[model samples]
Target: MTDTVLVTYGTTNGSTAQIAEAVADILRKDGLTVESRPARSVTGVAPYGAVVVGGALYAGRWHKDARRFVRRHRVELAERPVWFFSSGPLDASAAERDIPPVRGVQRTMVRLDVREHVTFGGRLEEGAKGRMAGMILRSGKGGDFRDFGAIEAWAHRIAEALAHT
Candidate 1:
């Protein structure tokens, strides 16, 4: 039998969406039916056998829509299997990974008891398409540093969990 998997995410520069698609591809390869969509497009979680939610982080936070989806479907999510991922914290350039104060969607996910969560490095375009992100980028912070290997490994873990349960 095939499983219905919903992979949803919120992205600023679209890196998170790329990550989500990669995850969905992994699941699809496992013989499951996967649908990838933006978090804002999701109306309900009732139709999915499993839910994978992810979003890019801005200023130490997950996107609002991703968090809101979990909040709106908390009851259903709790009853089913849900996995979460965040795209944030560009390369440390050193050994230290210091996460700032908890804020936004991440905080909301914690309250909802999501089964698993992962964080991947995000990228920022140095140009001036948007001022807020550009400011952060210009601050000498960093750029896209997502580890595709780690992402695939995490997706496989979720697949295993769903397979056994």
Candidate 2:
């Protein structure tokens, strides 16, 4: 029987949501069942064999909803395979650094025995809806920095790991 994986994320400007959807598509293409949803909307992880939790990173922290989701579903997540991803760091150099998860996220990562945590380059569009986000985007470092090929490669790795598990 095929196992279902849940790819849930919290996105500020929708870039992270796109990444989550890309992940779900890759998993599905690899013959696994997948569900992609926003972090705040996911009520439970009980139905999934594996879970991928992601969020937009701002000021070196994950979005609040993603952090809360992990905290609220700590026990259930601990009982299954869980992976975490942070989509941010518009600066290319920043993406190369091994950025650590925020304090609250760190605690939950420990509790859940998170399989992996990836930091991907993010997109920042000028004049976006968010106030601070717009200010940042206007700083002359905004463009589509997302590396789709890298994202797909990572998703393939996840698919391989899930297949073995």
Backbone clash count, each prediction separately: 1, 0
- The parts of candidate 2 lying over 4 Å away from their true place are 94-98
Clashing pairs in 1: 123-144
TM-score of every prediction relative to native:
0.85, 0.92
lDDT (Cα) of model 1: 0.77
In candidate 1, what residue range of length 10 has the lowest lDDT sum?
93-102
lDDT of 1 at 62: 72
Q: Deviation in angstroms for 86 in model 1?
A: 0.8
Top-scoring candidate (lDDT): 2
Residue 155 shift from truth in candidate 2, angstroms = 0.6
Error of 2 at 15 (Å): 0.3
Q: Give a tens-digit lDDT track for model 2, residues 1-165.
A: 337899999887899999999999999999999999999999999999999999998887898889888878888999989998888878774345666776666777887799888788888886566877777766787877777887898899999999898
